[model samples]
Target: MILRMAWRNIWRNKLRSITIMMAVALGLTAGVFASAMINGMMQSRFHEFIENQISHLQLHHPDFVGQQEVYQHTGVPRDQLDRVLENPMVRAATVRTKVHSMIASATYTGGVELMGVLPENEKQTTGFHNNVVEGNYLEKHGTNEILLGSALAEKMRVQVGSRVVLTFQDVDHNMVSAAFLVTGLYETGYTRYDESFALVHMDYLNNQINIGNSFHEMALLLTDIDHIPAMTKELEVMFPGLHVRAWNEVSPEMSVLVEAGDVFAYIFLVIILLGLAFGLLNTMLMAVYERTREIGMMMAIGMNKQRIFALILFETLALSLVGGVFGIVGSWAIVSWVSRVGIDLSAFDDVMKEIGFSPVIYPVLETAFFITLILFVMLTALIASIYPSLRAMRLNPAESAKR
Candidate 1:
């Protein structure tokens, strides 16, 4: 009976009821879309950073992570690497030999970390070619040519086909220098990488360091991201002498950004929810004022205060449900369309790249985020009705009748 009365009463002032519903719907739409877009962009950026820049996991000698400079002292053998890669969780693996060196040119000289990679295996495992900004990737099983980061090339005032001398301390602690032709230049948008790293053929390093079949570290690419922690655990148990670390573990900056983004998204969701709750409160408060006499008549006619309160609560709940349903459907349609087309940030490409971010991002609409958002909006509406419902229940029959 109370529900029927409340439903009828809402239609008595259709304009006001609809206005309130629109407010709730708009709030829901904004909250859902904004949260979904932000989360999607963040995930995309993190994934790209991990895939293009950092492989999923890395294996280092037990003491190498701390004493990375002493590559000769802490080298992982080929036999041990073969055993680790036997795990099905490991999708691809590559060996890396790193040495700090000074890259010198006629016009410039700067410190750089020389990364020796197997051209064929590195290309297949790391997609290194896709990141090349100019020229081509290093040839397999070749020497006398090298790839320089774009920033490093610019600093050196050298272009493709130019010659640069790379000087470094060999495994015997003796200075070894070699001059190689610059084959290509690549930009990863990260200042540190672009300014301080060079790629060389792995065999070149072996010859320079006089080491055969040895690597400073092993980088692994995983098929699925969720398997990282599990694979890390398995590697730790199987290879107790090696240290396993994820991409995020190796770089604290990326981890911090991911954590901060999650907190920001939650804060935005809460703020939108609070705004929707206030809108509901306003609507319910106005309903109480307009239906003062009606509520009093119900009290006089044997409807107890509990039923009166239930009536108002039911009205608020129905309004929220109707708005929530519409919001979900409407927001979903918008999100789907936008996700397919994508939001372009090309105008800010240079700025974004300068800050180490990708400009283009496509948001993903997850059903879980939508469902949770709807439930939270509905809960807010229900909670907002408590005070107004209590006010309606406290109305005096005589005073309301006189008014």
Candidate 2:
């Protein structure tokens, strides 16, 4: 059969065939590794964003999202918070008052998103306690204790026990400034969060502003993010007056990221595949040129041009198939091992943290990538074989024997 002939011809020059296989394998391995690394980094950023900033869902005053003014409190009574918590999918929830305000230390004044939180509840809602780099989380019944992010602290040159003035407009648009003692310095590893956000006790903002029985925002944690859609609808129906939204709705940039990541992976795959395709074309072309005399002999003995073309394509496909297997399986083994150990990126921590990324990355490649890459390699093989196969088909039995 033509298939068996093509298989046998490959072994006639085993060294050359093996060399091409190695080249394909190595090229694809590098591609897969790079793709996995990028995916891992993106995954880490999203995980951190969800864990530290956007809890799973949020409930806010309908007008709060529009203007975010001081007076746009969640109109829902405080006691109804229990009704939202009663859902089985709800893990934890916390209410907060937010104001874009300025925190002034002795000689520094910096803008910050001042958050009034119930410390213990917030721990369950957003992992705030674990992010604390210095000092403990807020006390249960604290008056004016504040938590400062490391970047904010550095910008203000303020440390623990430093008294800072927080000046913002109250609900009535009256300018009110309150003094808060910095009880803790927290570092969320996200420089933007650190540079612009600080935490304080909710009671201070509520009583100080005289917004009794009301909160501006409520953040929720779910048993799993998959439950967000269902929970959002449930809560929206329950608190019809409040604007309930999932994390993605709250952060459209992250929503776009989650959707567009696959496009990025495919682009990387195409670039690498093109590189491999050139190498494959060169290798296959050499195989055809070296086998010109043999190809002529076969044609003289009655093998047709179509059979010769088929033979060359089959050989190229076999070469690519073997290499594709090695590349996919081997890359997966490498990525799995590294995922456990993690690739230390401490050298680039400062730059990475500025982008809200973690220093260490654990490479991860989905099983789908292997299938896609294997098919892509097959397509590359098909394209690479065309020119060389045509060259073999054009060979003259009498003329090819001379050289």
Candidate 3:
């Protein structure tokens, strides 16, 4: 009976009911769309970091992380790494010998970390070859070939085929200098990583340091990202003396951005709901005020205060549901369309790229958020209806009927 009455009451005042309903729907639309776009942006950023910079897991001599010396490298070679790749979970792994050094051209010298990498293995692990803008990736046994980040190349004022001399310490802590031809230039879109690092054939550095097959780092890329924790655990057990870490462990700030992004998305949802609540509260309160006499008549006829209160609350809920449905439908349409084409913020490209971010973002929301939205709107209606429901319940039957 209450449901039937609530339905009839809302339509009797279609314009007013619809206005509040639209408000609710629009509020939810804004909230949902905002969440999806931000979610997409963060997800993109996370993947970019994993693919370009960190891969999935890194292994090194336990002291290598602390000492950061060329001598602290691992003695394991490519074959040792391939043995682990036999595991189904391990997709690809690459060895790198890192040395902190100054890369100098005739005109400029910049402090950089020289990363010695096996071309094929590094290509499989990092996909760095795909990112090359000029020239080609390092060739196997291509004597003194160097792949440089475009920003790093630019900073040193050199381009492809330019010879750059790298000076760094040998295994014995004695300084060794070598000249490498710029075989490739890569732009990772991550300016910091690009400007601070350079790549060369692992054998070149190993030969220079006189340590055959010695490496400072081993990076493992997985078949699936979800395998990170399990793989990290397995690798830790497999290589006891080596330091094994997942990308998140290596870069906590990126981890924090990913984890905290959801929190911020929900906070935005709440703020939108709260703003919509005020409009709902006013509409419900007015409905209660105008129906005072009718409510009293219902009470006088035989309805109890509980039923009367419920009827008023039900009407408000019905109104909110109408808005919530429209909002969900509209948001779904917009998100679906926008997700494919993406919202291009190319206008803000300069600002965005400056901070190592992409301007184009595709908004994406989880399925759970839609369910949560309906519940949130219902909750808002429940809270908004409280004062109005109480007011109806307080109406004096005889006096209200007379009024």
Candidate 4:
């Protein structure tokens, strides 16, 4: 009975009721779309770093990971790596010899972390070969070949086929200098990475450093990212002496950003809903004030205060649910269309690239998010109805009927 009365009473002031509903609808639509945009940007950056740089997990010499000393190698044997590769969860694995060195061209000299990698294995692990923007990926059998970042290439005033010298300390604390031919220029759209790293053949580097069959880092990509925790544990047991770390452990800041992004999104949504709640409160308050006489007459005719309160609560819920339905559907449609087309922020390409983000973003939202949002809207309606429902419940039958 209360539900029926609540629904009917809403239409008695159709224009006012619709005005509040549209306000709620529009507010929710804007809020949801904004959350989707934030989530898309964060997801893009996460994938970019994971797929193109760090892989899912990495194994490193404990000393090497801490100090990055050229002499601190993993010292794992070939058979150990073979066992790791045999794991079904590991999609690809590659060893890398990394060292800090000075790279010089005719026009410039700068510091870079030189990564010596096996061409084929590295390609499977990091897919960096696809980032080659000019020239070609290092030949599988290529010797003394180097891949430079496009930004570094430009800074060095060097081009493909240019000669560059790398000077670094080798094992036994000896400084060694070697020349490499720039075979390719790659751009990963991460300014810091582009400017800070270069690539060469792992065999050649091991020969220079005199670390026969030893590498500093072993990076692994998993068949499924969800298996990271289990795989990390397996690898830890497999190489008890080495430090095994998941992508989150390797990049704690990015992990923090991911968690913080979710919190920020929810906070932003709460703020939007809080604003709409005020509008809802005011609208319901006006409705209750105008219905005082009607409410009193109902009480005189045997409608209890509990029923009166329920009627107001039900009316507020009806308004919220009607608006919420429209809002969710409209946001879903817009999000779907825009996600397919993408939102282009090309105008801020340089800034985006500098921060390691893609200029184009595809919005995404999980179905769970919509479900939670609906519950939040209902909660907001319940809170907003409290004062109005209490006011209606407190009306004196004789006094209100006289007015």
What are the lDDT scores of the predictions, listed in order? 0.81, 0.86, 0.86, 0.91
Candidate 3 — what's its lDDT?
Answer: 0.86
For model 4, the stretches where C-alpha displacement exceeds 4 angstroms are 140-142
Model 2 error, position 1 (Å): 3.7
lDDT of 3 by residue, 75-99 (tens): 7665788777888998888888888
Poorest lDDT segment (10 consecutive residues) of candidate 1: 70-79
| Comparing 2 and 4 on lDDT, the stronger one | 4
TM-score of each: 0.93, 0.94, 0.95, 0.97
Model 2, CA-based lDDT: 0.86
* Candidate 3 segments exceeding 4 Å error: 140-142
Clashes per candidate (backbone, < 3 Å): 0, 0, 3, 0
Q: Estimate, for each residue in 49-114, the C-alpha lDDT of model 2 and write its tens digit.
A: 887788889999888887888899986677787887898999988888888888899889878888
Q: What does the lDDT read for residue 35 in candidate 3?
A: 88
Top model by TM-score, which number? 4
> In model 2, what is the error at residue 16, expressed in angstroms?
3.0
Count of backbone collisions within predicted model 1: 0
* Superposition TM-score, candidate 2 onto the true structure: 0.94
Prediction 3 TM-score vs. true: 0.95
